[model samples]
Target: MKKLYHNYIDTFRGLSLEVWWLSLITLINRAGTMVIPFLSIYLSDSLNFTLPDVGWIMTFFGLGSVLGTWMGGKLTDKIGYYKVMLVSLLGTGILFVLLQFAKTFEAFCAGIFLVMLVADAFRPAMFVALSAYSKPENKTRSVTLIRLAINLGFSAGPAIGGVIITGIGYQGLFWVDGITCVLAAFLLLKVLHPKKAKILDVVKVENPVSAYKDKAFWIFFIAMFIFGFTFLQYFSTMPLYYKEVRLLTVLEVGLLMGFNGFFIFLFEMPLINWLENMKNSKTKLIAFGLFLVAISFIVLNFTSWVGILIIGMLLMTIGEMIAFPFSNAFAVERAKKGNQGEYMALYAIAFSLSHIFSHNVGMQMVDKYGYEFTWNFITILALLGVFTLFILLKVLKKEKNT
Candidate 1:
């Protein structure tokens, strides 16, 4: 028992203080992430938009994200991550407040597009900042640490959001979310102020390759896009399923979603630490994670028992814990050999594109063919992603040997 306790303690050793501060800022920003998780419900329930309309609005959200990441990547390369992050956080905070007032479909679409554009710009900049803050050897663990903070925040956010929805209404979610983003921005400004902090740029390339020119990376990008598409259903359609089929209250649904975050918080770091020691292939682990997520979706089709929801969420959370940090580490490592901002931007864009397609496509599938069919379809797609990852693993190995 003492050995086990020490192992857990050892898992957190050697990270720089800046990484911890970055994680804290991420936690604060994400803790107020009440808006996105419940956006579909808000649009459908409050504004009375049709499913197709909701999907279109979400597509706009993705479009903004895609452009935002691209723009942020270029800006980070040109100006630096500090300025990009400051602008993104402050701008996103203001946008959220204004977005809540947009009632019409057109107005809401524009508002969400602008909001995500500004919000997602933070992603690549954060990755760049993460690279600057941590040593190469600690990359994956540092990513896992950030994920732990994100999950911890996520676990709390939904529960708090549910209560806010119940007590004051959905509008309250916007206010809290906005306030938190602004708070995080100020906190970042105070602590990691560019003048006071000298971040070592760990990733420096003499002649960096563009992300678009990398063939193996594009294959990996596709797998990540599919992975994001499938995993995101937990946030988008799964809540509606909990509400409609399972007859769960909104609060119950929030708690159920929170379970994923809580599970990740508890198990991910130790698991990653153990895996890191094994010196296994990152791509293989990611493929395995994809397989687990595929199983998570298919499990829903096998039973209607309420216990199955917990089982499915557990599978998904474990898959996320296995996949995300390694994927992030891989992207960062690859960027070290190439253009850091460009490579990380492309990585962020893959998930952002998935945001474009996941919510709308899942809703359409569920609406047209029922939830069972949708689950089956997503399962098939996820398996395809797993196969693609195996291909990437082979390709990466070949490149390394050459």
Candidate 2:
């Protein structure tokens, strides 16, 4: 027992301070940004907006995020990661503060769009920085740790935000989010110094046309696009499903999401390490994860019981943890040496496109076909993701032999 305990401690200690700090920053930032999960609730309950209006507002935020992610990648490459991170954090903080003053629905939507744009823009830059700092062998673990922190923060944030929303209202949520953003930015500025890279030093004004030409890149992007379509349901439609179909209380919904983060925190590191050692290919892991996710949805279709829902959520979270970071690491590994930023940018674009398409299309499908149909649609997408992975594996194998 003592030996096992000490080994566990030593393993944690072996993780770099940079990884720890980045994870901490993610935790703090996500904890404060609780508005994301409850945005539709705030619009409907607090702001008295219609469902369609809320959907439109979400579309704007998605559009803004698309631009933000692309610009963040380009800026990181052109200037430096540290500078882009600082700017994105500070800009998002200012926007969140402005959001507190939004009285009209239009104003609230506009503020949210601006804030989400900047907040999400920070993501690609952060991903690039984390990847750059990690050794190739450790890169996937590092990314998983960061994602675990995000889930931890998310788990706590919504539950806390629920209490705050119940007591003080949406304005309080905005204030808390803004304060956390400012603090996270300050900490990041203090700890992260950008080491100039050769890519940034060189002046290449050419379009990233070559990045789009990589067949593997396009295959990966398409797979992520399919993944995103299913994934976005968590944000846009799942809460409504919980509320309307399952008849869950606000606190109950928050607790369920919190549980998701808790699982990620507890299991992500061990799972990533285990997966790394598994003889199965990364593509197989992804296919397996998607299969689990599809199975979870099938489980979801039959039950409105909270216990069953929680079980399904657990399965989904495990699948997501296995797939997401691996996809990211694969993209980075596949990039041309000097074009890391461009490759990551395109990868980020896949996510943005997924969000836009899913939110807009998924919501409509939910409205028309109901939750069961929506889940069925997502299951089909998950199966398609598996098929894509098979194709990707064959291509990777052919390249390897060559």
Q: Best by TM-score, which number?
A: 1
- Give me the displacement of residue 165 in model 1, in angstroms: 4.5
TM-score of 2: 0.88
- Please identify model 2 stretches exceeding 4 Å from their true place: 1-13, 166-168, 195-209, 239-254, 301-308, 336-338
- List TM-score per model, in order: 0.91, 0.88
Candidate 1 lDDT tens digits, 38-110: 8889999999999889878978888999999998888888898899999999999999988899999999989
Candidate 2 local lDDT, 1-402, one digit each (tens): 899666545435445677778888889998988888888888888778988888888888888888888888788787866788888888887788788778687887788778877887787778877776666677778788888788778778977998998899888888888889999999987776544221222224354445668886788788888887777687768878888999999889868867777777767777777778775677788778777777777788876667888888888888888888788778767653445567777788888888878877877898899989988888888889889988999888887899
Clashing pairs in 1: none
Weakest ten-residue segment in model 1 by summed lDDT: 196-205
All models, RMSD in angstroms: 2.4, 3.5
The best candidate in terms of lDDT = 1
